[model samples]
Target: MISAALTVEQRQRLVRVARGQEDGDLLIRGASVVQPATREVFEADVVIAEGRIAAFGPGYGAARVVGARGAFLAPGFMDGHVHIESSLLTPAGFARAVLPRGTTGIVAEPHELVNVVGAAGLGWMLDAGRSSGLRVWASAPSCVPASEFEQGGAAVGAADIAEMLALPSVLGLAEMMNYPGVLNADPGVWEVLEAGRRAGGFGAARRMDGHASGVGGRDLHAYAAAGLHSDHEATTPEEARERLRAGLWLMVREGSAARNLAALLPVLREGPRRAMLVSDDVSVDELLELGHLDRLLRMCVSGGLHPADAVALVTCNPAEYWGLHDYGLLAPGYHADCVLLKDLAGFEVLETFVGGQEARAGSSTPPLPGGGVDLGAGWSAATFDVPAHWPVMEVRPDQITTGMGAPGSGDTRLVVADRYGRAGPGQTAHSTCWTSGTGLTGGTLGISVLHDAHNAAFLGGTDADIRAAGAALEQLGGGVVVVAGGEVRASLPLPYAGLMTDADPHAAAAAVGQITAAVRALGCVLPYPVTTLSFLGLTVIPALKLTPRGLLDVGAWQMIGGADHN
Candidate 1:
């Protein structure tokens, strides 16, 4: 039923060979096969005729066959959860970057791209992905603009979810970011959740996954009972264990920024409840260097987890949890998707076979046709604006915090201001920028690209550093910058919409690494960086954050003004 993809003669021949009436189409003669479904290990012959596995065991015959003499055959990996936009690479370009590492399928959430360009942007990615070799599935964005605190390119209502649900590739709603609305039964929230549920329940029925980052215990139970099943926000082992006990399918994630995987490997061997692996917000550079889901497999092994189980995390576990029918195995009648690994420790991919064809051309990656879509157009190749005086605006005398925003005193009451409609669902919150920009005294300064809210708000002794950095951002369109002493100190041009660079992903990664040296040259106390990016706009992550708007109190869901309590 997969259309005229394969010729009739090919199908007949596949059927004949699978039934053993004739010789097989192609054969992987003598290689050790790891079957994740049955947890079986054996040396066998794997044969494929028409896009699906035709036969297995001692012998096979076909017109053309691959010789995988010293390799491990694994089902092409599936990244259970992801946000393709974070990479700053278009779908076509992202695929080109990851395929060589043996990732064949990805469950991507386009909420960020949707925010930047709306449904047309999502539609752009879906159409482009379909024609490519890799298979990409979508999850109807549950939170279009994410939250009210920031501005985006567009907003999607329930009607949009319903429309997206109709697509064959849509995989239910993305992580429901609005827990407050769900708790209060807000109509807008329910409208989108219900539409996605309808689509998920179509045909064989799918599930609406949850994104409750900080919600736990009774609240977690409330969310699970409300029909949201899976979550990737379980950052700690205790958090993940609780979700697992509550029957929520857990997706252990390890993207470029967030790395909560090391603490969760013990759960992999605890039982067979639904546990999946995800690359939630990977960039092209990380995907190119460390790989995708396969990266998790290697990490698991290094962390003392079973290699086969690690592979299972990417294959059978996710397919079963997400209800993907045509993928995740290499048995008779199953789609012919397999990855050949040279070893199990690092689990290096020697070759990847998809639908009876070798996905790679020789040892090198195949060239993308017409190359691929360029994402550099999202914003100009410039930096942002900086003021003359980096407002050290204060409400009290004792609050001079250097890094991220946090209230200095623990007792002063904050003025409940909702001047702008930037508060989340039922919460009243205050925002920065517009007011802080008003009263500015000129001087020299410094800045960091605060990962949580995109650009790092300027922290300065004088306004000149901030002004120069802002000028550089406007000139480069978007990227991280630091201005010091009224001149550009150091800058990294994120030409891909102020988020990523168009340079080779490897070079981009190396460029990002250069910051360590630059920061060492400056002597600061910012501990770690990539992890910092993960906490951006993440009201779910515990503790505090510095947003482009201001410092936010995640638990209270509001921005704490100067002199507010910690």
Candidate 2:
């Protein structure tokens, strides 16, 4: 719960403790230390004072001492890049779930909330992080609406980026999902990038994260030249190598929908210094069933990576990249954020400490603030009507990107409605399309958790089913719903921003599990149906996407009529 930086008085006390002139506050004794800086493992007793590591070695004395029982002690893990909103929990709720799994810190991008409520949402996230018991640093969302193709609750420009950079907790500009804009030298995009560069004078040089999926050759070089520091969308070793060669930090992502770790392992094996592990978007079910960065650590170790190297991927590597100097190390003068593990091979976390305090599950969550979801007037079951001969979007298993399908060739009908009522004058409130590969044979799926813009989306086999599911979601105040034969089968209410719930992590996760189960029972072939469904409305990623505007041909970068007039 203590700040990572030390005060003047705390520094003096730490010096006294290091000099053996004063007793440390606590001592973790008899442990094999995993030093990621040098990739070394050695035995030491870590001494903590003023919530910082004052010293570590034999003969260190403290008022309280706990035996490690020959455990492996490493610096607390950190997620290089993540969207906490993807977990469908409040910041406190997210901390409760990951703290026990050895994640003491993260570099989160609150773009999802910002997309729903604009810059005000960033303030809410910062407040929530202060009480979450996790050291949460943030990158101001650079792409507020993701792109002009989609309509978000608010639009952020250079001025907003400059103001956000002034906040101490906000490290820099978040993932610039609009790589095309950068390549085309859009004045707005350049202005935003310039804002981040200007913010560098505050302290550490401000960083700009990237999201260049399928970008390569000259385009990739142009993206890196725009001063983007890292990219998390690389799905193959070639892509990872290309980004690294372009002088960009490679963020290997393994989230609920995008599992790129195993595929990008070769790049990590060849050169891990410039690479870090990240969970771009993890679901509540995954967070509860599996661990956070700890799961990534185990995956790395099992995939032929040395334990120390794997630990560094989630620790020192990210710290150095994100300019978190006081973190990712268990050395003197650093914050005493440590994790005790039962073994190196399994990377089983026995205990997690943040600023020298043992992090307990569900101890840090506070009451969440309000104002995320706001549905427009006149929304009802009739809002989901789809015209015949509409453009179709094909969903691929285990990928967030989508491809174009033949018009009216799919059974599942897709509808996107603006929840915030922010559409321009003369613009329609909703758009209708079609989709294939959802594997839904006879039910309707409705969710307000649509990516970026967070519009209400409905996919169903029949008009009645779609209407029923849409109505159920509206009644629940925004969440996911499954309906069949005019009856609501299962639903999870996400009252906050229509993206997350303030409920406990376990309860929220249980609801998500139930929703997933219902979707699977409805004949959905995708492993993570809700997560996949949410991205269908995202206008940024690949070939084709849908929004309240209409069907978007992402490659063509233009909105096309969904109905096939031919």
Q: Give each model's whole-structure lDDT.
A: 0.60, 0.83
What is residue 466's positional error in candidate 2, in angstroms? Answer: 1.8
Provide the lDDT at 283 for model 1. 58
Worst lDDT 10-window in candidate 2: 372-381
Residue-by-residue lDDT tens digits, candidate 2, 346-440: 78889999888898544444444443433444443244555665567898878899988777687677777776655344332777777889888
List model 1 lDDT by residue over 207-255, tens digit each: 7878887789899998888788899887777899999889999998887
Where does model 2 exceed 4 Å of error? 1-4, 202-205, 361-391, 422-428, 562-566
TM-scores, all candidates, are 0.79, 0.95
Off by over 4 Å in 1: 1-11, 22-25, 201-205, 360-462, 482-503, 524-531, 546-550, 562-566
| Root-mean-square deviation per candidate | 8.0, 2.6
Q: Pairing residues by index, what is the TM-score of model 2?
A: 0.95
